[model samples]
Target: MRPGELVPIRDDAAPRVVERIALVRAAGAVPLVGDPRWSASHWQQVQDAASRAEPDPQIAWAAVTSGSSGRPRIVLRTAASWSSSFPVIADLLEAGPDDAVALPAPAVSSLTQFSLAHAAEGGPRPLLPRGRALVAQDFAEATVLHGTPQALRALLDAEGSPRLRAALVGGSHLDPALRARAEAAGIRVVAYYGAAELSYVAADHGSGLALLPGVEADVRDGELWVRSAYVAARYLDGPLRRDGEWIASGDRATLRDGRVHLLGRMDDAILSASATIVPEEVEAQLRTLPGVRDAAVVGLPHRTLGALVAAVIEPDPDAAPSLDDLRGAAAAVLAPAHRPRRWFMGPLPRTASGKPARAQIVREIQTGEWVRLV
Candidate 1:
């Protein structure tokens, strides 16, 4: 580890993640999670960026993009940027000594890595589920689970966390049905909206997504621009760049009554029937429909309309919704352009962090891999 250098720390052991972070910071190198899933070329390109860029001793850790939209790149931020939000997180989660916070692969997720770091500073006891498959027995000792909506659903599918009391959810929309399932299991849920570039933007404790402490938000040109100490300083090799002290997230949102309502990512917007449709608005509507476990709305190539609104559904194992069922339900809520014309039901394509892989789904649909419904 040297000045402006990146040290790849690859480990699944929860306890050691903090030690690795500390060691890298002490040695004047940026701590970067060496996810095995990342290609050698991508890793090398990030390393090259670190080697070329001027080093900042304050920059504590680095995380790569989730690749939900495009190529992954390094996001640099200070250790204090995350630690500053620990109290807010602690207040939000209330992880007691008796509570064990369960999360998956730390080597791939900065969220998990940050959770482990938080644990190191006396948050909650971080626990790795017993085996590869997150079964009920794996979370037998756990009281709280930290993950995205997709990860939570996977845990629920694996016979559920019987003893779990709370879930800290993020990364995507939390469907009403999913929330109801957790509530039925006696597990309380708290969700927050954020990006790797902008740390903790707004959190939904109970009501809606209110801006987190030390964050100032503004909706500019339909995108949320955040000014916060928690924002990452730079991107190693990506299109997104910070403007001064503020970083603009690609999320299309509206800040009203001091709460943020996310529409969708600008990349996920569908241009259909001469209208721009935000996929999240459609996906959120679809998730409320019966028999849908989760959903991803994407824009597929269309001959006349330029792009047609399409949907890929992750159906519940017990029951799957038909094309007509979804369409009929969507008619009441979504505008014609926002309504998905092509429908496909199956397991959704997700990134390493469990966010919908919209670009991947579009490609799958284009290649005739995901069969469209009438």
Candidate 2:
């Protein structure tokens, strides 16, 4: 098959998706699974990337990276890279042949595709909801749930949580308060850390994420490096930093008590005149403030400092927290330099996978598209 030739998948059915994946692998054709929500330009970019990709007979599939921090690209992976972890993940979720796995996400998302591939192993055909809004009836027979933290939170808020063996949550940082709520409702929330290139790096039940079995992880110069059978083969457009078997994760983390505590993305660090601040850390504290539903922190260009910390918050509908109130609350937990210098109140822009679109938000803020609250 030609490199630029595309096999677009729009069907969300589990069996159909599974069959198509198998067929593409057999034919050595690149499969592009994109939702209709993607613009025509996005498809064109995928085609362009495919044309530039070096042909690799070992590549079984291609998936678009979630462009939360920057532009999206197509990543190449062999079937074994993902299939090797099915048994481990299934065991973690306690899935059995008779159990029904429910994946409440779009078909294009990597998490949904992974769930579908796992379900194809022997379990009863999985239940795949069209969108994130899942009703109580959707999980009536489901034994396991797999989705992002936002989707799981929506499910809990809508249906008050259903009985499940386990809930595997990923794609973004899992807020401690949200996990507490889910746990209080009798649902086991397993938070995982992974990326498009590296699958199933680490997971945690209550403590920090511990490296999965058969996975090797090391922290070097404040960045995480992973080596495992589940690592992707290569990137179709950009370069993946791989030193032999180790793949640089581009994430900053710390090893504490044999568990991985992720600080944030190395690229998301904010440099001020006096110190460096990690946005994820500040955002976590911001989320705990009164009347704050969600928050995103980014560094804006400044005259004296190279960059200044700024924040965008999704305030609660009933009560919107003022800048002074938020600052007062954050002051207790955050250092003086870490507090947000500029504040905007509104819904944070997110990507298809429900991750905060940091690059796009920064651009909007720089261009005056986002109104400043302070």
Candidate 3:
């Protein structure tokens, strides 16, 4: 079987390699069995956990990359596929065996591979299952801390342990203000960019995100395309469009000098009555104001306009900025159509990956569960 090819093994499957061999035989494909570099026992444990979770193992040639599409699913990757993506990540982070990094996210996610691969020791330096509340214990060790933006925010709130010297924030947008705060707090937070398909293409290594070594980034008609060592083989569902060596990334980006400034994903853009608006643009402006710890911008259905911009902000407890003040600030910096029509101040919505859940925000707005902007 090819690397990342799903072999249907149930939770009760045994002797993983041997069982997988049999399964592959049954499926009429040759099986590679195991890789010595990563632990077989660990692989068995992972397989067992996966089987227990899902009774039917419908193996596929490719894996699905979720989160961007709003569903958690696996995408296919070959041993070569992942290998092609690693060097750029290593070069971007300037990583080596000496680098000790704390990865709060699970090792399974493509999102965490940059941290996992760079650390060399691999896996969680120490896994601390977050209880009902986040604890600061995780950041006590390791020079590099990798977490999603929300995870960083919560960790900063719960522990704020300024222990870790540098951070790599991913799986969501890193607001400039938040990045500034982390810098001010003595933790250098750099926002890295990648999707499951392209493990890591670029990161904010300099003033803006620098394209990782072995990666090519360019924008076409406002959509971003990445030709890199890291692009995945294919999606489990189907093949993804590729232009020559480059993969069509759904994200929108602007390449300035050698760095790229990412706008939000193209699908997330909201078309109001007057014009199309990117919520991130509005969110970025809102985040600059004082008292806004975290923010999520979403398009909610409106009677007249197809969608109205809504700002859901998590206010800092110590100093909360007034809603009117936020609106006024938006008015000064943004165009009339670009400003959010309503502001909802509360704890922001987030996904399991620690990225803001725009889908959840839309759902809440539709169901009237979310607080109305007054």
Model 2 residue 296 CA deviation in Å = 14
State the lDDT of candidate 3 residue by residue for 257-369, as single tens digits.
88888776677877564245666666776777778888888887764355687888888999988877787766655545567887787887799998789898888877978
TM-score of each: 0.67, 0.68, 0.55
| lDDT of predicted model 2 | 0.74
Candidate lDDT scores, in order, read 0.73, 0.74, 0.59
Cα distance off (Å), candidate 2, residue 337: 28
Q: Name the regions of candidate 3 deviating beyond 4 angstroms.
A: 1-64, 67-73, 84-87, 117-133, 160-162, 269-374
Q: The CA-based lDDT of model 3 is what?
A: 0.59
Residue-level lDDT of model 2, residues 1-374, one tens digit each, is 65434466754554576578657645766577865444455555555656666567676666776432113467777768888998878777777678776777666667777766666566434676644346667666776788777667777777633656578888766778878988887788898988878988999988889999989999999999999999988787656799999999988999888899887768777756424576777787788889999999998877445578898999999999988898777765565567788999888899999978889999998888999986
Estimate the Cα RMSD of every predicted model relative to the unseen true structure. Answer: 12.5, 12.1, 14.6
Q: Kindly report which residue pairs in candidate 2 clash with one another.
A: none
* Deviation in Å, model 2, residue 264 alpha carbon: 0.9
Best by TM-score: 2
Clashes of 1: 0
Question: What stretches of model 2 exceed 4 Å from their correct place?
Answer: 1-6, 11-28, 51-55, 68-71, 131-136, 160-163, 269-374
Residue 338's lDDT in candidate 3:
62
lDDT of 1: 0.73
